[model samples]
Target: MRLCPAPGGPAPLVVINHGSPARAADRPGLRPAACDSEAVQWFAARGFAVALPLRRGYGASGGDWAEGFGRCPQADFARAGRESARDILAAIEAARRLPAVSGDRPVVVVGQSAGGWGSLALASLNPPGIAAIVNMAGGRGGWAEGAPNTNCRPDLLASAAGEYGRSARVPTLWLYTANDSFFAPAIAQALHAAYTAGGGVAEYRALPGFGEDGHRLFFGRGGSAIWGAELGPWLAARLGRPLASGAAR
Candidate 1:
């Protein structure tokens, strides 16, 4: 995994992307749709650093998608979770090296779909040093459901909760769309219940937009609504300052 550092001086970092965006050298003729570095720029402009990490199979990162990353879609959702756990561990290690990262400052993980699950997995496995998290349609509870699309296992979240969820308290935010094809809006509710039960704090909002749904809007230009609306303020608050509101255009 590689850390894409946001510009500007020292600032706390936010890590995003997992699953599909990850690179698997063995897989050919496949590419992740383009995404926005808005989180990097938006947070950097407001004085926070954004660390974008691509997991094993998606981008330029080199690795055999099968062994190094996670199991295949044919394996089952449980395999996806297993793979995600390894990637999350790598992303955390990489995040610590960012130049804009504040040693004393905690980080905010902003994830969409699979990335969001990784954020929770990280929180459940690591320390509260992570500060905060932002999830856009992160998968939850009904793990068996999204099997076709995600490799995430539902229970890993519980496993993470058992291992690291408690004691590692963090402020979290969620943004979801009701029409999410990858999962029903119920997944969002399950995410809320699970995170809270695991001893994490969270705030969320679910919207309505058919066709444009699915756990994809957390990045790219479409994700700006969540970023400019809730996430921007969240990072600002996490930093003990505030971002100018009306600036989104």
Candidate 2:
């Protein structure tokens, strides 16, 4: 776990989750985001202490990989997402115990790709202290045959999203790029429709394509400038404070 505290007194906590690699073999090499990473620094600059935790079976936290959703067509996306949420919850609980984190303030959860999927699952539980969520290109069963825009079972994925939405009351922001290779616009729209239809409170935004693949927009260089602009006002509204200027860099 990498905990980067903001300057001054205790601050609201923001737990940022990492995504699952397309290849299972890469899991073992995964590592927690560095304290200086753009995402972590972005939160720190905004007066939010950031915690980046490596889930079980990844990097140095190895044990057993519990988030597998079986094979392509038979994938149990909902179950896998719940498993990932369990770890995210654990990270939140642990971070809350730190003095650098303000216990009185609500937490913000941010995730990309599979981690974003986990955030949605976590929202379904409606865990206390989680004020909001930011999902960047979140989804599963993408690139079934190592091809862009190819999903294993989009219908099932949408169904699973509905299942999560039934109990997810916290407001959420879902951001996707037009050229996201993982979850294209059509799939993203379908997921959003199903989720909102099932009572989820989410605002979905489709941005213009970025770089070669929009799926990497959140982590790519200069990516924060784009997403941060949208997030600033949204987050300020929830936190009831204006964000400090020049924080996105």
Candidate 3:
């Protein structure tokens, strides 16, 4: 689904990728392709064309869940993430055809959770025209059955971050929360450290704790207020334009 303001001319594009469903059984409901309405409006109102793609194996675009990452104990986080990136890149290519989308303008990729991780992987490729990336609680592993913040292999996840960071050139903004059960501040910090140490240009912000799960921040009703302020300024600086004060609201 692609949403945009009334057409005038080509405008800056925002590729908004969604996260994967928690369970495989949920794929059937994906046919309609769920999205954060507030997020769509938030970016659309700000004079950007937003593209939301329902990747393969989900929604009507069913095929296979290319991003399975193996199973629990030995999950391949990196492989799964890169596979997701492949779909996102394909979406970018399709988005270029939207009449309201400007192919030459700065492209900003925003993703939540698994989607965010995919965005990070995409960064490693340094795709043409992508100006920056915003990762909202980006990570691969989370909530293992009864355990909280217990990923399959934390060390491997950090190493994967370093692996992506090594080839990433685009500046990235990562948002997380102190109380996130998925990737707590400590682990998030470790991953950030590894990524930066590997030469990735990334700015990480650990916001104050949100409700029960900060991982929901990007999709929650008031999520914009938390990420909007920081994002507007970053986009303005990156795209060499001034954004309206309350544009994100």
Across 1-249, the per-residue lDDT of candidate 2 in tens digits comes to 878888887989999999988888899999888777876777888888889998988888878988888988788999999999999999999999999999779999999999999999999999998988999899998888788889999999999999999999988999999999989999999999999999999999889999999999888888888998889899888777887754533
Each candidate's number of clashing pairs is: 9, 0, 2
Please give the lDDT score at residue 157 for candidate 1: 41
Candidate 3 is scored at a TM of 0.92
Q: What lDDT score goes with residue 205 in model 1?
A: 76
Question: Which one wins on lDDT?
Answer: 2
Error at 111, model 2, angstroms: 0.7
Error of 2 at 35 (Å): 1.6
Model 1 lDDT per residue over 1-249, tens place: 334444445656666654342332324543333223554556555555555666665556656553232333333433444466567656765667756577567767776666676665555555546777776676533334334333344445434433334534667777877766565665556657656766767776776653464455555465565446766666678768776433211
- Sort the predicted structures by TM-score, highest score first: 2, 3, 1
lDDT of 2 at 216: 95
What's model 2's TM-score?
A: 0.96
lDDT of 2 at 118: 94
Q: Pairs clashing in candidate 3?
A: 30-59, 31-59
Question: Candidate 2: misplaced stretches above 4 Å?
Answer: 246-249
TM-score of each: 0.70, 0.96, 0.92
Candidates ranked by lDDT, best first? 2, 3, 1
